[model samples]
Target chain A: MEQRRKERIDRGVKVRSDSIYALMSWRELSYLTVPRLLLIIGMLILPLVVTSMYWQRVISIVCIYALLALSFDFLAHYTGLVSLGGAFFIGVGGYLTAIFNTTFGLPPLVSIPLATVFGAIICTVLLLPCLPLRGVYFAIVTLMYPLVFARIIEAMDILGGTDGIMGIDSFSNRWIEQYLVIIVVLLLLFGLRRLVNLDLGLIFRAVKDNDQAVRASGMSITNYKALAVLIASGMGCLGGACIVHIYMWTGLSLFALDFSILPIAATVIGGAGTLVGPVLGCLILVPISELLREFGTLRIVFYSIILVGFIVFRSEGIMVYGQRKYHQFERWIKV
Target chain B: MNKEPILQVRDVTKAFGGILALNRVSFDLYEGDILGIIGPNGSGKTTLVNSITGFIKLTSGKVMFRGKDITGRPAHKIADMGITRTFQIMRPYYSMLAYKNLVIPLFSPRAKRTGGWRGGGKLGDRDTVSIDILEEIGFERDSYVPYKLASTLPTGYLKRLELARCLALKPEMILCDEVFSGLSMSEIASMIPLIERLQMSGITLIMIEHRLRELFKVANRVMVLNFGEKLIEGLPEEVIADARVKEAYFGSEEAKEVMDHA
Candidate 1:
């Protein structure tokens, strides 16, 4: 009996340029650099290309979700810390920005950065006791934080209560609003790309692989885990700060469960581990959700169908599949 | 055997709830000696290794390594102090490539201080060092084997990779848990020479084996456990000839097999 199998191999240029000698040729260098540049340029032009005020705002929202998804990917995939705390981080940052803008009389630029930093510190400290546990224990605690915060604020009528903080500062202009997030996304995406290849990233990945072995290597897993949490929360809070500035108001809606759930769904649809895939997933998803706005509440049903379809057919996620295709070519070989 | 024991287990006991898995066991392992721990199933051989290496806390006991009490230290701390062990069930990182599995331990503080497997001066290129360790443990350095994901490797290679992982720490002692199990006759033959080579290179070894014949040949002393208590302890010949050992192992088919091997 004759048999054949599909074999995948890296392309000649990809394999040959596996090392840095690719610098010798413009073709090899461009092969490596073009895709990255295209993404950055495409994102920069997206708002202007759309020309609709509503959709331009959608681009900003997509970038915001992308930031949250990036934080989720870095935490769950790299450190084995599956945080359902996106809303917790978002709420904390949003509230802080609201407080800074209103009470402290800070401008949008200063307040957002202050909110990001202080909010991360607050999140980290509150999350410290839970750091020792992973998996569902961590997830439950994180998922509870937003609900807890919402309940506290509602009952006490603190931080503007259900009415929320009205008249928060807005971005100076729409251009700054769009480009600020767009530029930060590109920086963070590339920064994380580089970070994962560094020594610290290797340790983060090792923590995911076998934390017991990492411990055996004579390092503290708890400390590394804390660092990972800090980095992830910082990203999430930055997104939250951006949201407060864009909306020019803050309320209990900032603590909405959608803020928590959507980033995770985006991560799964785009790809779990690839930092950029979650961003791509958010870009695809938020737009679809907005388009399905015509269907009203049925938007959720269509969304679930798309999510379930992705999980059922391509559970490895789009980026993993796309990455394999881009880096390697497949051919049938006789066995 | 070299004088002054490298490791001493003084009345080590471990109990899980109401079950006493290790009942006040004691032994001494000198530098440059091979100790074989053998027993029937459920005799706590692996538990002893775990307790000593601090994978599990001892219910009551003391473990001394190089004359210092290391009873309750964590596994990694014990490993960092130059004592390393292979899992009875292999725990190689499945997602990583075979050689890449060594990257973490190769970059360990112990590896840096001790100069890793070859005991060189400066820690050279990690990838090259990883491939070199893999090659010494039966991997072909230039072949595609080292590049293969660890999960793809057969049991024999995985066992060798487990040993390779310990070697990456430049361990002074290697606690092997059934390393010879699930291997072909030829594979075991090749592996015997590797074990001898590691001992010759000045690392002490403790092997827990159900494969008594081969184990008895290399082990200078043998300790037998039955129902988590020491049954007999002596030279391998004396242990094999003991009436108590035969009687304790009576119902088990492994008894007749070991007698035939003897």
Candidate 2:
């Protein structure tokens, strides 16, 4: 009897590129660089390439969602903290940047950074109590934070309340705004890529694998978790700050669940662990969202269909699927 | 060997709502002794390991490690004090390579301070040290077995990886929760020498095992637990001879038949 089985093997170039031998050949080097280059170059030119003024604005919006998705992916996949606080972080950063620009008279440039840093610190401090809570508990607390902030703002009738903080500054020009966000996203995407390979990243991953075993290894899981939250929240807040400036306003809407929900959807469609996947997902999803605007409320139905289709069909996500195709080839071989 | 016991458990009790998972269990483990704990399913064997290693809180009890009361201390604190454990359901870092799994424990403060696995007062080159530990625990270095992902490894290798992780900490005492449960006869045969070698290195071990034949070979003393209570504690032969332990393990009818044959 004859039997055969399908086997998957890494491409010769991929194998070579995985090692020091990659430097010896331009083919191997290019194999390593091309996908990354495509991402960077593709993102860099997207603002100029999109001719429509409305769609250009959508690019900036996509970048903002990408940042949120990146943060969500990092915390959920790497740190095992399934956080739904994207809205909470965005709300904090948006409001803080608004106050800095509107009340303190800080420039858009200065306020964004200030809001990002302080908002992150605030988010981390607030989330500290819930750091010990694992899995869904951490998620529920995070989900509640934005709602609580929203209600508090609505109830207290403070910080412009329902009307929101208006007359806030936009970036000096469209180019600066577009490039600023796109560059920041690229830098963070690459920076985080490096970070997850570092010793601290090792600790984060270990904490995720089994906190009990990590504890058994004598490292405090709580400390590593706090550090991961700080990093993730910082990224989300940066996005929030940028969005506030882009919109020229900050308000209760900053705490909207769209910020929370969309990034997670982006993460799922793009791939959960791969930081770039979520960004790619936002690029695909946000534009489709904008395009679907003509359908009015029915856009949500189209949105759900697309999401459900992706979940059911290509659930491993586009990046993972793409990576596998790029790196390995499969063929039937005799057993 | 009249030295003071290194680990002392006094009247340890754990309850889940109205049910007592562990009822007033107390035992002393001395330096360089292999203590085997045997029981049938849900006999509180694993629960005892959990309580001592600080994996769970004790309802009312004292766990003293070398005269220091370590009761209710966090698991990390207990591990830092040189008491490490391996899970019965091996919890290897699935995404990491086999050697990388040990690197985490090797990076621990305790490993750095105490020096890991014959580290000779210097914890040097963690990657190399981790590979060395993996090789020592039967991972074939030449074949790149240590370089393979932990998730891909078979049960035999995963079991060894579990022990390798504990050794990376240079632990004074290791609470092994069923290290032999899933292994074959030849694998357990090979594991016996590794157990003896670990003992020879002066590290104490508390093994919870169902394989009584293999366990009796290594354990200096045996304790039997029945329904969350200590049924008996004695030498392996003495424990085997006890009618109560047989009944607890094999049930009354089967135990009587075995006893009658004996």
Which portions of model 2 show Cα errors greater than 4 Å?
A1-7, A50-53, A132-137, A330-335, B241-262
lDDT tens readout by residue for model 1, B178-240: 999998888998999999999999999999997777898788899999989999889988998
Summed backbone clashes in each candidate are 1, 0
Model 2 DockQ (Cα-based) = 0.65
Taken over the whole model, the C-alpha lDDT of each candidate is 0.89, 0.92
RMSD of 1: 3.0
Q: What is the TM-score of chain A in candidate 1?
A: 0.98
Clashing pairs in 1: A216-B76
Q: Model 1: which docking level applies?
A: acceptable
Which candidate should be chosen as best, given TM-score against the real structure?
2
DockQ of each: 0.40, 0.65
Candidate 2 residue pairs that clash: none
